[model samples]
Target: MSEQTPALSLPLIQPSQAQKHVTHNEALMRLDALVQAVVLTRDSTSPPADPVAGECHIVPSAAVGTWSGQDHALAYFDGTAWQFLTARPGWRVYVLSDLQTVIWDGTAWAGEATSLQNLSGVGIGTNSDSTNRLAVAAEASLLSHAGAGHQLKINKSVATDTASLLFQTGWSGRAEMGTAGDDAFAIKVSADGAVWNTALSFDPASGFASGEAVQSGPADVTPGRLMRTDYGYGPGNVLGVVSENAGIPTGAVIERGSTANGDYIRFADGTQMCQFNATLAYISAGLCSAAWSYPMIFASGSMPNVQGTLDSDSLALTAPSVTVAGVTGLTVSGLGSTNVTLNVNTLAGASFGSGESVDLRVLAIGRWF
Candidate 1:
C-alpha cells in the first residue's frame, strides 16, 4: 500500500543484474593475471605451495594439485587458485633452466636450433647427399694457424704407410708424392692404380735427389744421382762422375783433377787420344857390320815419320872395301808407316864384321783415331 517501509528498499534490485557485474569483474581479473604473462618455473609437476598473485608457470606432465590433468599448459595463479591454458603449436617459451628458446611443435617442445644424433649428409651453401657427405661452397677455404713455429704435418701409421696428395684425372689417380715404402719423399705416377713407377726420390739424410729415367723395360731404366756443390770440393763447385756397371773408366767424357797433370779425356772404350811426355825405345842386334836392317815394332795402327838418334858401344874399323873413312856411322833407313830400319856403314863406303848392337831413341807422335 504505497507505504514507505524504510528509507531505502533492499528487494528492489534484480538478482541477474548483480550476478552480471560479478561475472564481468571475474573475467577482468583473469585477464589481468594472464595478459602478457611471464612463466616462473617449468621444472615442477605440482603447483607451488605459496604462489604470488598474478604469477604463471608452464605445467609439466602429470601435473599435481590444482594443475592436475593440465599437462603442457600455461598455469596462472589467481591469488587463491590456479588456472590453466592449453598450449598450441608454434608457441614459443624461454626455458630458464636450459637458458634456451624453445617452441612447441604440435605435441612437444623443441629447441630453436636443431639437434641431430647422426647425419648422413651435410652441406653449407650447397646440397649434399650420401656419396658426397660433407660439402662446402665458397670463394676460398683455409686451414692454418695452430701456433707460431708449428708445422702442418700429414701423418701416417708407419714408415711404409702412404701419406700423400694425389692428383686425379676424372677421379683416377695420375700422380702422387709422399713416403711410399720409407721415410724418403718420392713422386710416383701411374697409368692405372694397379702399377706405379717412381719418378723422383729425395733422401732426407744426405739431402740428395735421384731421378729415374722414363723407360719401357727394366734394362732401359737408368737411375740418376745428384751431387751437391760441397760434395767433392768446397762450395761453388759441382761435380758428377758417371761410371759403367763394372766401375771401369768407360764412357767418361770429361775427367778433372785438382792438378793439371791429372786432367785428361778418353774414349768410351778407355782409349787415350792425346797425352804428354810419351816415350818409345828399341834395341837391335844381328845387323850387318856395314849393312842396314829394319828392327822397330810400332804399337799403333800407323806410324808418322819422326827424327831419332842412335848409338853403339863398339869400335869402328876400316876394311879393304872402304873408300874414304876408317870409322863407321849409323843412319836411319827404310822409313815406313809401321817400321824403321837402321844402317851401320861408313860415311864414305866402309865394310866391317857382323854381330853389332845399336840403341835407338825415337820421338813418336800419333793418335788412335
Candidate 2:
C-alpha cells in the first residue's frame, strides 16, 4: 500500500464501445418506435441491391448490361470490347448467325473478317450463304424445284444404241430417241415415249411400222427413236421390260414384243390373221429350259403369234422348214395367200401346231365361214 502512492485513478470512455451500446439499445427498443427507413439499404424488390452502410462493392445491373441513351445497346470500347456489354462476365447470352452473329442471336449477319467475303442486306445476304453450301450427297433427287428447277438433261448427238442402256428423266420428262430415217428399235420404258406410262400404249389395231428404223416402235419410243422424258415402267424407275419366261416355247425365238407404234403390237393391214397352216417348226439358238436338249417343244397353239414370221402354203408344199438359226424375236400371224414366192431370202414364218390357231380381228366379224 505504500508503494502505489504515485499512481492515480484514470477513466476513458471508448467511442466504439459507446456506439455498440447504443445499437444494442435500439434493437431492443419497442417495435412501434423503430425507424421505418432503416431497412432501405437492403430492399428485397429492386435489383443491384442497395449498398450496405460500409460496403464498398461494385455490382452489375440492367442499364449497365445492354442499355444506351436512345438504344438497347451500343458498342463502347473499353480499350478491348467495343461496347459488348451483354457479352460481359456473369452474363451468358449466346448468339446465332450464318455462324457468327454480329447483332444478336438469330440474326442473319456474319463477321466481315472471318465469314462473308463482302455482303450487306436485310436478311442473310448472298455471300453469307457460301459458308454453308450444301454437301455433295445432301440433295434430294427426283424432287421438283430442287436447285431451282435446273434439270439433269442428257443430250444425244450420235446414233445411240439405247438397247444397251436404260434411261430416266425428271418429273414428266422422257428419254427421247430420234433417228435419221428408220430406227432399228426404239422403246421408251414400256411405252413409246418415256413419259407415258401405259397410256401411250397403242391400241391393237394402229399398225405403223415402216421399213425404216424410225418407222417402228411408238414414234419416239422406237429404239433409236427420240424420247423426251424419263422411261419409267412405273413412276419411279426406267422404261424397262421384264420377262419371266414362265410360260413360253423352248425353241421359240424369245424376244420383246416389238411396238410398231406403241405398246400393243399392231395386227398390220388386217387385225384378223387366222393361223391357217402352221407349216413347219424348229428350235432356235437360245435354250428353252434346263430339261430336254433345249427345253420342251412348245404346243403350237400355246404361244402367241410370232408377228415377223408366219407364212401360208400354196399346196402340200414340199420345201425345207425355215431355219430359225439366230432369229432374235419372232411374231406369227394370219395365213393369207401372198403371191411373193417363198425362197431363202425370205424371213420364214414362226409355226404354231399344224392347224393350231387363233382368230385375229378387232371387229365382231362372225366366225370364219
Candidate 3:
C-alpha cells in the first residue's frame, strides 16, 4: 500500500513505524491552516517580524527571508517553525487586505462573484426599501453606454398612467415633466404641492402644443405670457373678420364686407373705410344735391370725413342749356355717422336747367370702434 494519501498527499502511518503521531499531527496542523481558509495578505513579500503561532499568509512572488522561493504558497507559522502548502485550482480564500473572497484560477487569484441575478435590492452608500429597488445616495450617478450613445427611458403601462420626473423641495413636489396622467407630454408646477398648474403640454398625434399659461387671444396683451400660434392672423384665417364687444376689439386682424352699392373695410387697429357711388340730380344752376346711407356705420358719436368727385362717364347737361358740365365745388351737409347729403356747385350762376344726372364717387374714412 502507498505511504501517503493521494488527494492531500498526507502521510499515512506504516505498520512498523514508531512515533506515528508526528505524521498524524502534521496532517491536523495543515488542516487547521487550510480549511475555511483566510490569509493576512496576498501581497507581503517578506514574512512578519513577529508573527503569532497559527498565523497564516499567502506568500507572493519574489518573497524574501524565510518565505523565499515559496511564491503562490500558503505559509503557516506553527510555534517555533514555518510550514508551506501548495495551493490548487478552485481553492477559495478570504483576503484580509481587500475584505473580499478570491479564488485560485491556476495562474492567479481572482475575485469570486457573490451574486449576479434576481437580487432583492441594491443600495450604494444608502439603504434601499421596497419602493426604491435600486437606490444610490451620492452627489451624482451616471449610466453610460458600453459603446456609442446612451438613452434612459421611463415607460408606463398604459396611456393614462404616469411616467415622469418630479422635482421637489422638502419632499413636496414643485415641478414635474413627462407623460403624466395621460399620453400627452406635460410640464406642471405647484407652489404648495396641493394645487398644480399645467404650464405646457404637447399633442401626441399632431405634435402641436398648448398650455394654460399661453395667451388666449389678442386682447390678452399681457406681457410675458406665451403666445399661441393660432391666436391672431395666421394660416387659414388671414383677412378674417374681427368682432367687437362693448367697444373692445377682439378676434382676427382684419374685417371686410362687400355690398351691391359699396364696400367697407375694417381693421383691428380701429380704422375703417367705406367707398361707394351715388347719383345727384341737378336742381338748379349752382346746386346739385343727393342723399345716401353709408354701407358701414362709423363708431357712435364720431363723424367720418366724406369726399366726393363726379364720375366722368356719368354726367349730363339740359338739352336747351349751355353750361360747363363740371362741378366746381363740393360740400357735405346733414352729416352723421351713418349717412350724409352731398351738394355739388357748378360754375356759379351758369344757366343749367333742372333734373340733370351727376354721378359722384364717395369715400369716407374714420374709426370703427
Each model's lDDT? 0.53, 0.26, 0.80
Q: Show model 2 residue runs off by greater than 4 Å.
A: 1-135, 145-369
- Scanning candidate 2 in windows of ten residues, the lowest lDDT window is 287-296
Writing each residue's lDDT as its tens digit, candidate 1 over 176-223 gives 998877899989888986687787788979866665633333233234
| TM-scores for every predicted model | 0.37, 0.18, 0.76
Which numbered prediction scores highest in lDDT against the true structure? Answer: 3
Per-residue lDDT tens digits for candidate 3, residues 1-369, read 898777565678889889999988888888888888998899999999999888998888999999999998989998778899888898898999989998889987889978759988999999988988988889989888978989889999999899999988998999999998789999999998889988888899988777777776656757767876556557655578766666665666778997865899888778889988777767777677888688888888888988877555445433234333545545899888888888777664455466665667888999978
Clashes of 3: 0
Per-residue CA lDDT of model 2 for 1-369, tens digit only, reads: 231112211122245455565444333331211212111111112222333221211112333332223122222222222222122122211122122223223222223334555544223222223533422222343546766576545444555422223444443334433332233333334333334321122222444333323323222355554332232133332223322223321111222232221122112112212222222222232211111010111223332232323233321232233233312223323312221111112233433223222211111111111
Question: In candidate 2, residue 104 scores what lDDT?
Answer: 24
Per model, how many backbone clashes are there?
0, 44, 0
- Clashing pairs for predicted structure model 3, backbone only: none
Residue 169 displacement in candidate 1 (angstroms): 2.5
Pick the winner on TM-score between candidates 1 and 3.
Answer: 3
